[model samples]
Target: MMKHQIARVLVLVSIAGTCLSTASCQKTDPNRKETIPVCGEVYVDGQPAAMLQIQCHPVEGMDTQQPTITQAVTDQEGKFQLATYEAGDGAPVGEYKLTFVWQNFSAVAASYSGPDKLKKRYADPGKSPFPLRVEKGKQVDLGRIELSTK
Candidate 1:
């Protein structure tokens, strides 16, 4: 009699614990932004432009509780992976204006500042002609973006 009641109580507690754990695990914040992967390469005068920064800004009506600006750094081969919400995660779905900036570490260190090797027009987001869109659950591959040294 007493043993049966104790067993029933234990079973009920276990069921309740499982339900609570499942609910907590599935919980998601409504304000959390969703993102999709974006990647590309940068080129200068028909060659890969390495060690540069690439940024994407929402064109319009894309802002949320989370930021829409996605940024990436180019590798040795001029490859970049955009990250908005997290590292290498991706960017929110929207139209974006793209911009670039060369690291110029050697020039900065040598104090031989003259002008950007890849043209100054590529730096400003407002003036940049590169416009892109990110779609949900889709990976966007921006082919070689060419820049002129002259």
Candidate 2:
């Protein structure tokens, strides 16, 4: 009877430890903010700006929940899907200062390059004129954004 009781206690302790570890792994912080899907298209010189990165910076007074920045890369069709914590998971609903960057010089040369295409000013978030607000549970569509060299 003593041996049986000891075995039962060991089993219970193992189960309790497993349960605690599993719960801890999936722990959620109270400070975590909700996120929504954000989608947009980028255009340069009236054409699709494919394979470019779009970084969304959290702006003060616009993002009261959390200051988590999100980013997405444009597809071949100039479409992008924003991601915050995961791939294509979107971002927290708030206003964001958008910055565009195209670092792939080889890809740029293969696709299209002109005086109206690559503009360095558009890559600076502080100097960029693009500002967007993402709505919760709603898809925000940023229409054709033209970047001009002039």
- Output candidate 1 Cα RMSD: 5.1
Which 10-residue window in model 2 sums to the lowest lDDT?
A: 108-117
lDDT of 2 by residue, 31-139 (tens): 7777788787887767787878788876663455455668998888888888888788888877878888765636535653434245566777777688988887788
Please list the C-alpha lDDT of all candidates, in the order they appear.
0.80, 0.77
Top model by lDDT, which number?
1
User: How many residue-pair clashes does candidate 2 contain?
Assistant: 0
Candidate 1's residue-wise lDDT over 1-150, tens digit each?
Answer: 999999999999999999999999999867767878888888877788787778887778456556455798788898888997678877888888898877465644753244666667688877889998989888998878887777
Model 1 CA deviation exceeding 4 Å by range: 1-30, 61-64, 106-115
